[model samples]
Target: IDVDKSVDLTNCDREPIHLLGHTQGFGCFIALRFDWIIAYSSANTNDYFGADSDDVIASPLKNWIDPQTLHDIRSAYQASTITGRNERLFSRAIEATGVPVDISIHHNGTFIIIEFEKITDDRVPEDSFVRSMLSQFHRYSDSQELINSTAQYIQFLTGYDRVMVYQFLPDGAGEVIAEAKNENIDSFFGLRYPASDIPKQARALYLKNLLRVIHDVDSEPVPILPEAEDAEDSIDLSFSTLRAVSPIHIEYLKNMGVKASMSVSLIINGKLWGLIACHHYSPLIPSYFVRTELELFAEVFSLELSSRLMREREDESNRVRNVHNQVMASIGSEGSLLGLLEKQFDTMRALIQCDGIGAVIDEDYRTAGTALSADWVHQLTRYLNRQASSEVITVDSLEKVLKNYDTSSDKIAGVLAIPVSKSPRDYLLFFRMAQTQTVNWAGNPEKPVSFGPNGSRLIPRSSFALWQQTHDDRCEHWSDVDVRSGDSLRVTLLEVIIRHFQERSELQS
Candidate 1:
């Protein structure tokens, strides 16, 4: 891919970032073949190794480092190969410059890539400090409390201008659910950003690489010498610690008045769930050790979050199940499904979290909570029956699904239809009232594209002002637990309907 080619929002996702053939200036990279011979080196290798690319390329690894350092590299290489991950050697002395540096070694299929960054901050957090942070996390069982505490702890540790827990919504947009920022800076809490801000390819890379750091967005990238004639065949830097930043992304950060940034992926069940995004207003290059610690923190946080969500789901399921058992017991004692539901309508509504509940049994319609006209309930039942599926049907926006219906007056925006019988198409429908709310966006999301430096390509918006948008004609989305409860209720009601018919037939005979 041509890095300098003009691109618009439509084609930006096709950018080949892994084949950029460069590294950040803060660190130097070297790729060694299987025989320990250097195959590729960053153009700025002489700055650290005191050897030009011409002299280092094709040379044995022993030519640059002392024998002891060479032995250590080999050991780290072996460990990386065994673990299938990058191995780190911190605070190692470079014999040529006599400077202490941190080394990261990894095997990229055909070559061993080694990255070096000079040691700047040698300070390590005390064990007690780490324990204290973990203990803070342990004190919060609520998801929001945990998320907010994470932002606070990260900002406290890194001293960034701002740290946000940005969660991905269903529409691919991101929302800043929690934030910690310096007193002088404006808050970005509760603000949303369009999906274009982080394109699809960028999200895929974040999933593969758990952490990314942009030390200095304005610094020039050091090109890799002997750049592959064909960009597709360039050395893959997918896992490099010092991979060059995409030009467009640099422009994005600059527009936001940021000089440095770091993002830690929060993955759940092998999916990209959210991000821990940190921004610095000035150039800041954290030591590799500190970055590594942050990576560990993100991993531990993801696990705890996944476990907490699963436990909450289980508790909700248990509560719904208890309500369902009560409803079933009442039906058995009354020997009439309609009689039991009409008498204990509120209890039936508790089977799921919804604003109202309605049931349609052979020519009879019963409703509780929010009132719905019998004609409208019958019309919705006919609409659902046409689908010809026995499974639960959930719709968050009734207008989107039912085109000609006048749903604005009813103010019921969501529906969960559980099919109880196939012949008559009896349904137990859960309805939710429409809600109107304001969304705070970091900028006008619709105007994301603007002329770039060349005026030919589309770049990110140049502003970060708060833009508010009012959203209506929708209700609270039905969660996975709600759907599951609906399905469970569907199955139980089907069994009851079948037995009732069987007993009626026997009595008539």
Candidate 2:
């Protein structure tokens, strides 16, 4: 007797007789043999199977045969014991509803939400419950070293070539505040990108979609429409992942030799903060499971990072305000304005990450505490004497266009010169460099630049020189935008400095 248990099983049965057991399979002639079986949860048939009385259904398939079918079934069955059980469960729900779509997740700060909608492609609204939990975790964070540490942690977690704290600028430009990059790639530690790199439309799309996966830039195209349906036209790129990259953009990445890029947009305070951009040189594909895990971890990291940044900004603001107040008071007390400014260098140096601090004042362009050796200063004197020097102007100029300006043959690696108030008044300036230590300007630093027992300056050579040659358009030999008022730290410092001076002026009057 053959047993067939399909939708129409009754039609396949030839003769039906004897006593029957509901689930234990005890039919008369085939008493000990079980052919036609209906098991709800296996435990319901435990009597004949000799299963322990307390045993529950361990699996839906209880020792069934047919090797190929068993292998296929097991392959499709993802145990709920895994980390993404919730996503898998959601996938099942969608599958049950007969939807042919795939799901993706978008994350920002402490909030995590499904990138799906009941009737549309938009992401779900923020979950208040998730936000509350995130806030508590942030409160427990160790904020002092959080920015740098988190950058490192997230890079490790996501396996990205580089992880950066990208802050958006007012005119649509973006700048890197902090970074963790691979061994071969140089730091863009303080690099800037035009607002055009990420167009307005791309940003809008990013707002709607939290994450984008570019598995392989060189992957074979999955035809958007059947080749039979339309053989003449190319696919629209806006929504299709398979669309070919625009020619200009492809050439741009090729020029830089960036093979793959994965970017996660980070939103903080309901605004676009920047992104955690991951770069891979070789062709790579991250599995769905890996992507899901990475996103969860990345969300946690981004939240911590945003919280730390905001708090630091606030703290810096208060500190600067206090220092400025003191400066104003000192200016009125018993010292020259230049002297008072000199006294403030300690605080300014600490705040601006500068090794040296100086300014060009009035007609003579007087110098204060030299950040470099006196020998280098003499070389700089020539450039400083020019009636119209880029040293005084805010825009790009002669002082900024060259890579190694100091006639000492030692290049002035970085400088921040700003005309704070202009005219006869003092112009605040700041400078910083990894002394005797060549910066990993063009390629990633596998080893830290070695320095002698006594601190000096790093000699820029090889890749550093090569980088200056190639990126001369963007490189500034002495001037850096890090001191720009728009920087979070600079903004806080200026406010504090201004407030202090205002109070001091009143005290003297």
Candidate 3:
């Protein structure tokens, strides 16, 4: 259905970007050899030092930094994992004019990299305020509430027009679960964004870099110069604060009528759970101080969010455990297999929150609730059981995974099939109806990636006409809570069946 299983994402993750020989305009990066000679630098050296890119080449790194500052950096770089040193200065006449520069130093194995970013934000959000903000976050009882509050607080803190908590779903796609927007901005709440928006490699980098900000989307990117001789030797800007973004991403933002953007990663247990995406109608560059505070807030928020999610899972598990008990009780007092199941049909259906529930014993069927005809049920069950493992078989899209099924006639898009006994092919299947969702795509989701005049490289979509399309025959995904119920049901039913069969065998003997 809406599950796109065939599209090639080859370009999404393999975008060899750090070698693009450039950086963003806000900062200038320098790579130095151990002997203090400049090895590589962004071509836009004029922005910071008013020197040609080559001016840094063969020049002692000391010339760019005062002796005291150089000594501090050397001490900090002694350990690879000690964390980098960050200090700011009112750089008087270091370049065309006096401005604030946030200087940073770190080592990347091959080279000692230094970066200078022009800072505009003079004052960061205060510590007391951060604590108060965090205290308010703890007041929230659930993850969704915490995220919703985070969206509002981030938008308020950063002064962006809109902020959204875009949570990734099981299948690469994502949904905006929480959003806070200015009165004039459009609502993106509940809108599902395809995985193509954020490719796999980009996601990996988000874990490494907490904050990615683009002050001016239209500004040209600074290129890295003295092009790296070998692609492998190219700097992996996976950690670069000013790493240039992919051209396609810039175009994608432009089409959405956004001028500036920032994303703060929401990392849960070291993996990215979502992003706090901020968008502005005009260019907005929060100072390094403000961004630093944002990063701290994001890290703390991640820990808080993790705690809330764990609580939710615990609550769900308890509910499932209770359902497990009731289902076992019904099966344990069995008369006829079909009659016992039919009596507890409501409980079984609620266990997974499906459109219908079905049971097939051997080649025959006994079912309750909305389901396909007996013949179709048998066919679907046989097909799913073959592809299934000992664990629960979860199908979000029957058509995509089971190619032999008649897609046109099937109203059930997803199925959770569990085997109670395989000898007679007894199965308890939960079915979900196709949920045709609506999406307001920035461009046609179907034509998300196109080609430029060269007709080789993938380009961003050319349109932003508020394209609305009904997603394919997909259903609300089965959550872990639902699967837990199935797991309990399978174990309980299997035990009862084995015991009953043993008693029958003993009587016959």
Candidate 4:
């Protein structure tokens, strides 16, 4: 654990978070076998239930709960087993403590985990409020507006100091697309954070558990009783609501001056898209009912966001398809491939979103718009022929991939090259001009380590002041839609080439 020697940024990803063998102090945890015998219990369970861990272990769960409550627990366990999702019971009073608690139940491979937190608020959101939010979402055709409204609504509902829509970029890094915060606090909107900030394993856990809350970052973690000697064999708390926070993550929040925080995952197409991250300046824990409401809101928001994105992509695709059809029609009537391309190069450039277009068929090479010199095009084609294997090649920075070319004064930064034929090594190339962007980060992404209370281990940076960075020699990345369009054009051009060969053969015959 020596920060100066063994610990580095990568250690964050290697941390065994799921086997932490602890729970937050505000809640208690109990794990039972399918046969209803207790297998594991939190060390602080007696503080709420007044039963010792030694006595609780190896005992039937029915010994603690009334018959009716036991039946409800069984039913909930059955439902969870059927659906492969967590089941919950809200505002149920335990027989031993007579305290109303919110219970969450889920099963891992070997045990069924039940977590209990004392109920502080029982009010559910009004039906009208939720309906109004849904109505507002439908009214906005733009995704940015929708996301902004979502952040505002969440801040209002949770009474958090700040709420942000943290979106994962094409690269592993994240950007704050929208923000709602108190006037006193500085805005984090449009700020970027490196991928290492939230390591790969942490992102994976977020996918498994949709919502996470840290009531108080400064509170001590309650250990699980009968701690395993081997860390590898410790209890798996992947889905536990009361799972202890990672020490590194706690240090991170402390550095940000955050006392409490919560995040709800935004999932699209079964992949983790981003997070609705909330920050509180002081310790705060929302009631279970309210947290559930927030979960529902996030779910609806994800669906709406996914729909809007898909619709936008479809609109762009339709526009490209129209241009493609026009080009194909002209080629069919003109009965020439390269000739038609040369004549209608302007229209062909509009088929995909790019600054320039080029085509290499056998020996003849042609280009249009802001393209490279003929020699450069020929060299690019040769490079593509050597690197590509019947698939499209996309590069956002030509300098990084293509060598021997003087890129110091190169105007074109990106390329999407599609191979049309293998024999002649013909290609259809799309080019994009270089662009410069200024990015504001919360802190220096390069320097995320510092010595802290826990010896020389790596800790979060102490300051979150704005750190500006300028990026150069890159272009707007070619999106999936662009790749699809390029592939479609390649297929149609291949068809046209085959048809011309067939017609010439018939004439010769």
Residues 1-509 of candidate 3 have per-residue lDDT tens digits of 14233434455578775555567888888888899788889988766766788887778877776666677667656743365433333232233334457665667656787777775555543453467678797588788888888888888877999999988877666788898999987788887766667888788878877888887888988778787788666786766777787776887787778999999998998788999898999998777666777888889988988887888878877777777688666554336676666677787777678888887776667767667668677667667667646778787777776656653476777888888776556778888776553233334555444445423534444322111222355666788767877988888777767766666667669
- Whole-model lDDT, model 4: 0.79
Q: Between candidates 2 and 4, which one is better according to lDDT?
A: 4
For candidate 4, the TM-score is: 0.77
lDDT of 4 at 290: 69
Sorted by lDDT (best first), the order is 1, 4, 3, 2
Question: Per-residue lDDT tens digits of candidate 2, residues 156-262?
Answer: 65577877767676555567777888988877787666444555656765554455555445543222111223322322223222223333333334445566666
Candidate 2 residue runs with Cα over 4 Å from true position: 1-136, 139-207, 226-261, 269-272, 279-304, 329-335, 351-356, 359-440, 443-509
Error of 4 at 217 (Å): 1.7
Q: lDDT for model 2, please.
A: 0.42
Query: Which 10 residues in a row give candidate 3 its minimum summed lDDT?
Result: 462-471
Estimate, for each residue in 87-195, the C-alpha lDDT of model 1 and write its tens digit.
8888787787776778999998888999999876545643434556677777896888899988998898888899999999776768899999999988889887766
Local accuracy by lDDT, each model: 0.79, 0.42, 0.72, 0.79
Candidate 4 positional error at 61, Å: 3.7
User: Best lDDT goes to which candidate?
Assistant: 1
What TM-score number comes out for model 2?
0.47
Ranked candidates, highest TM-score first: 3, 1, 4, 2
> In model 3, what is the error at residue 431, expressed in angstroms?
1.4
Off by over 4 Å in 3: 1-7, 79-81, 84-98, 121-129, 228-233, 328-336, 361-370, 384-391, 400-404, 434-454, 457-482, 494-509
Which candidate wins on TM-score?
3
RMSD of each: 5.4, 20.5, 4.7, 5.6
